[model samples]
Target: MGEKTLPQAGQRGAIPEKQAWKALAALCIGLFVTLLDQSLVAVSLPRIREELGASINQVVWVSAIYLLTFAVPLLITGRLGDRYGQRNIYLIGMAIFTLAAFACSQAPTIEWLILLRAVQGFGGSLINPQPLSIIHRIFAHNRRGAATGVWSAVASSAGLFGPVIGGVLVGTVGWRWVFFVYVPLGLISLVMVARYVPKLPTGTSRIDLLSGLVSLIAVLAVVFSLQQGPELGWTWWVWVVLALGVAALLLFIRMQRNNPRALVPLGLFKYRNFSLGAFAVGMLGFTVYSVNLPIMLYLQVGQGMRAETAGLMLVPMGVISVIMAPVLGRLTDKIAPGLISKIGFSAMIAAMTLFGILMHLQVTPAWLLIAIVLLGLANAMCWSPNSTISMRDLPPELVGAGSGVYNTARQVGAVVGAAALGAVMQMGVDSFSFGAAMGNALLLPVVFLLAGLLAVSRFK
Candidate 1:
C-alpha cells in the first residue's frame, strides 16, 4: 500500500508514505494554531477586561462565545468537508480564521472582540474535523495510530503552550498581539495545506440542514444557560433555556434518526468502541477545560506569581506530552486501548486529586510541577489512543461524520466544563476564599476523569 499509485485529481488513492507524513505535518500545523487560540485568551482575560473596561460577565462571554460557536457548527462542517473537499474546506476555514484573528486584534470594545471570536470559532469548526478525517483516509489502519499520535501531540502541546505564549505577549507587547500571533501561523498552515494535502474523494450524500440547525440551536441554548446561570443567579430564564435545549436536542435526535443523510449518523453509535471512546474524549475535554483557568488563577492570584512565571509552570505538561505521545500512539496500535486509557485516567485522577490538595495547602512550586508533569503524561496516553480506537472501526463513508461527532463531543465538554467551573468558583467566592474555591473546583475534573474511566472500561 505504501508503494501504490497516486490518485488523479478528484479521486482517492494511496498517498506515498513520504507524502502522507508531509500531509500530516501540514494538518498538524493547522490543528496547532486552532487549538492554541482556544487557550491563548485564558491568561490574558484579565488584561482584556481591564483594557476594554468590560464587566466580568462580558469578559467570560469572550471565551464562552467562542466555545459555543465552535462546538455548535462542527456537526455540519464535518459534512461540508465530506460533500465538498476536506482540503478545500480546510483552506477556506483557515482563511476565515486568519482574517478573524486580525479583526479581533483590532477590536475597540469587548462586544466587538466577542463577535469576532465567534467568527474565529465558525472558522475553527470547519477546520477541526478535516485532519482526523484526512488522517483516517490517507493512512493505512496499521500506521494510523502513530499519525494520530502526532496529531494529538500537536493539539495538546498547543493547548498547554498557549497560556505561556499569551502571557509573554500580554505582559510585554499587549493582549492584542495574542490575536496577531495567529496571522503568521495561519499563513504558514495555509501554504502547507495547499502544497501537501491532496484532494480526496468527495461524498455525494445530501446534507441534513434542518437536523444541523436543530443541533446547533440545542447546543447554543444549553451552553448559554450554563454559562450565564451563575452570573444571573440561576434565574428562571436559565431553567427555561435549559429545558428548551433539551427539547431541541430530542428533536434533533429524532430528525437524525429519520434522515438517511444525517449530519451525525445514528448508526455510528452501534459501534461500542466509537460510542465509548467519544464519551471518554468528552470527559477528557471536561477535565482539561474545567480545571485550566482555576489553576492559572491559583498560580497568579493566590501564589502571586507573574503571568510569565505562571505560564512557564505549565511547560512541563506540553514537553512531556510531546515526548510521550508517539510512544503511547505506537503502543495503542499494539495493545487494548481500553487498558491504556484506564491507566491514563488513573494517572489523571491522581494528578488532579494531588493538585487540589497541594493548592489548598499552598505547597511549594516543586510539588505543583510534579502534578502538572503527571497530568501531561496522562494527556499523552489518553488523546491519541482514544481517537485511534474510536475511529478504527468506522467505515470510510462514515469517517467524516464520525470525526464531526467525536470533535463535537469534545468541544461541548469543554464548553460545559468552563461553565460548570465558573459556577463552582462563583459559589466558592460567595461561601469561602478564592483559593479554597479553586481547590474545590479541581475535584470536578476528577469526577469527570473517573466518568471517562468508566466509559473506556466498556471498550473491548
Candidate 2:
C-alpha cells in the first residue's frame, strides 16, 4: 500500500536513476542560462551606457535593479515552489525570463531596459530554487552529490565563458545581441523543463506572508542603501534607512521564531550542519561575488592590460573550478562532515593571500595567473561540497524551505559583499596608489574565506 501511494506523494521512487540524471541535466541547463545572462549583461553595460546616452549613475541601475529584484524575493519564490510545484514555477520563470529578455533587447531607453531587467531577474529568482528541490526529490541520498556535483560544475562553468562570450557578442553583434541570445536558450529550457523535469509534490502548506513582506522591505532598503551609497554620499537619511532595514530584518527573524509553520522553518537550524553550512555559503557568496572587482581594476586600470588579456587571466580559475566540482561532489556523498570544505576554504585563504602578495610586490601576470588557478581549485572545493553537506542532514519535509533559506543567505551575502567591497575599494583608492588600493581590496576576500573556514571547522 505504501509503495502504491508513493508515486503521488513524491514521484522519484518510481523514476529510474538514469532518467533522473537527465532531469537534473535539464534543470542545470536552465540554471546556466540565467547565470550566463547576469555576466553577459554586465559586460554589455558600458556599451549600453554609450548607446542610451545615460549617466554613470543611471547606468549602474541597469545592473543593480536586476540584482535587487532577483535577490530580494528568493525567500518567497522558494516557498512558492513548494506550495505549487517546482516544475510549474520553473516553467513560468523561464517563460517570464525569456519574454523579458526579448523585451530588453528591443528596449528603446535605459529606463525601459532597467524595468525589463527587473522582470528578467524576477524570472530568474523563480527558476533558481527549484533545481535544488527537484534534485532532492528525484535523486536518492547516495546519488545526490554526483548529481549536485554536475549541477555545481555547470553553474560554475556558466560564468567561466560569459566574459569572453559577452565581450565577443558586445563587440561584434552589438549589445542587443547579448539579450537576444538568451531568448532561444530560455525557450529551450522552458521546453526541456516541460518535457524532462517532473512535477514534485508540494511540501509547504503555509507561507509566512508577513515575514516575506518584512524581509522584502528590509532587504530592499538595505540593498538600496548599499548600492547607492557610493553615489548618494551615505547621508543621514541613508543611515536612517539602513538602520530601519536592520530592525525590520530582526523583526522578520522574530516573526519566524514565533510562527510554527514559518516560511523559513527555524527547525532546520536545529541541525548543526545546516546552520554552519548556511553561514559558510554566505561567506563564500561574499567572496565569490565581490572578488572580481579588485582583480579587474588592478589588471585593467593599474597594470595596463587589455580588457581581453585581463579577462583571460581569470580563465584559469574558471577552468579549474569546472574540473573539480563533480569530484568534490562525489567526495561529499562519501563523507558526512565537511572535511573537504574546510580544506578548500583554507586553500582559498592561501590562494588569496598569495595573490594579494603578488599584487603588492608587482609580480608578472604569469605568476598571478598561477595564483588564480589555486583559487579556482579552492573555490571548486568550497561550492559543491559545502552545498551537498548543508542539505545532507535536512529533513525531507523541509527541503524546499531549506533550499530557500540557504540560497537567500547566499544572495544576501553576495549583496552585502559587493557593497562592502565597493566601499572598501573606494576608500583604498582614495588613500593609496592604484596597486595598493586594489591590493587592499583583494585582502578582503581572504578575511571572508577565514570566516568560511571557521564555519566549516565546526562541522560535526
Candidate 3:
C-alpha cells in the first residue's frame, strides 16, 4: 500500500514494522518541537519581560495563554483527528505552529505576543494528541510500552534541553530568537510527518461543539482568577470568577453525561487505572511546568547566575532523563505499571521536598545539581509508565479520544500549575525574600505530587 493508504483502524497487526518506526520518528519530531516550544520560552521569560516592558502578570500570561489555549481545545481536536485523520491534522498543526513561531518572533508588544502564543497553542493542541493515538494504532500491544517510552523520552528531553537552547539564543542573539529558532525545526518536522507518518483511517464520530465551548470558558475563568487573585487582593470578582468556573465545569460534565458524542466520554473513567493515571499525569504536569520558572528565577535572579549558566544547570536533569526513560519504558512492559509509577512519584516528591529545603537554606550549586539529577530520574519513571497504564485497557476505537483526554488532563494541570504557582510565588515575594518566596512555592509541587501519589495508590 502507498503512504496515504494505511491499514484500517484496529488492524495494526498488518502494518510493516519499518514503517511503524519511521512514523514514530516523525511523530516524535513533531512532539519534540511543540514540547520544546513549551519549555524554551520559559527561560527567556525574563528577557522578554525586560524587552517588552511587561508586568509580572503579563509575563506569566505569555506562558499561561499558550498552555490555556493548548489545554482547552484538546477534546475537540482529538475528535477532529478521528473524523479527519491523525496524520492530516498533525501536519496541519505543524504548519500552523511553524508560521505562528515566526509571527511570535516579530510580535512588537506583550499583548501581541500573548495573542500569537495562543495561536501557537492552538496549533499545538492539534499536534499533541495524534502521536499517541497513531502509536496506539500502528504499534503492537507488546511494543506499545516501548513506544510510549520513546514518546516520553522525547517530551522530557525537550523539557530538559529547551532552557539550554533558549538561554543560548536569548543570551547571544536576542529573546526573539527563541521563537525564531523553532520555525526551522517545525518546518523539518512538517516535512518528515508528511513523508513518513501513515495516514490512519478516520472515524465518523461527530464532535460536540457546546462541550468544547464550556470547557474553554471554564478553564479560562478558573485559571484567570487563580493567576490574578493574589495580585488583585482576592477581591469579590475573583471569587465570583472562581464560582463561575466551578459552575461551568459542572455544566460541562452534565452536558457530557447527556451527549452521546461527549467531548470526554464519561465511560473512560469507569476503568480504575485510566482515572487514576489521568490524575497522576496531571500532577506530573503541574509539577514539571510549575517548577521550571521558579527554578530559572532562583538561578538567574536569586543566585546572580547568567542565563547560559542557569540553563546549563538543568542539563544534568535532561541527561539523566534521556538515559533512563527507555530503560524504564521497557521495564514498564514487564513490571506492574502502578508500581513503576509509584516509585517515580515517591522519588519526585522526595526530590521536590529536598529542593524546597535546599532553597530555604540557600544551598550551594553542588547540592542543587544533585537534587536536579534526582528530579530527572523521577521524571523518567513518572511520565511513560503513567501514560502506558492509563490507556492500557482502552478500546482501540477510543484510542484517539483517550489520548485527547489524557493530554488534556496533563495540559490542564500545567495551566493550573503556571497560574496557581505564580499566585503563590507572588504572595511569597510580598512577604519574604526572593529565595524564600521560591522555596515556599516549591512546596506546591510537593502537595501536587502527594495528591498524585494518592491517585497512583488506587491504580492497582
> Which numbered prediction scores highest in TM-score against the true structure?
2
On lDDT, the stronger of 2 and 3 is 3
Give the best candidate by lDDT: 1
Weakest ten-residue segment in model 2 by summed lDDT: 1-10
Estimated TM-score for each candidate = 0.94, 0.95, 0.92
Better-scoring candidate (lDDT), 1 or 3: 1
Q: Flag the better candidate by TM-score, 1 or 3.
A: 1
Cα lDDT of model 1 by residue, 203-227, tens digit: 6487877787898888888877876
By TM-score: ranked, best first: 2, 1, 3
lDDT of 3 at 355: 83
Model 2 alpha-carbon drift over 4 Å, by segment = 1-14
**TM-score: which is higher, 2 or 3?**
2
> Any idea what lDDT model 2 has?
0.81
> Any runs in candidate 1 off by more than 4 Å, and if so which?
1-13, 432-434
lDDT of 2 by residue, 207-306 (tens): 7778889988888878778777767888999989889889988888888886866878778889888899889988987877677778877888888987
Each model's lDDT: 0.84, 0.81, 0.83
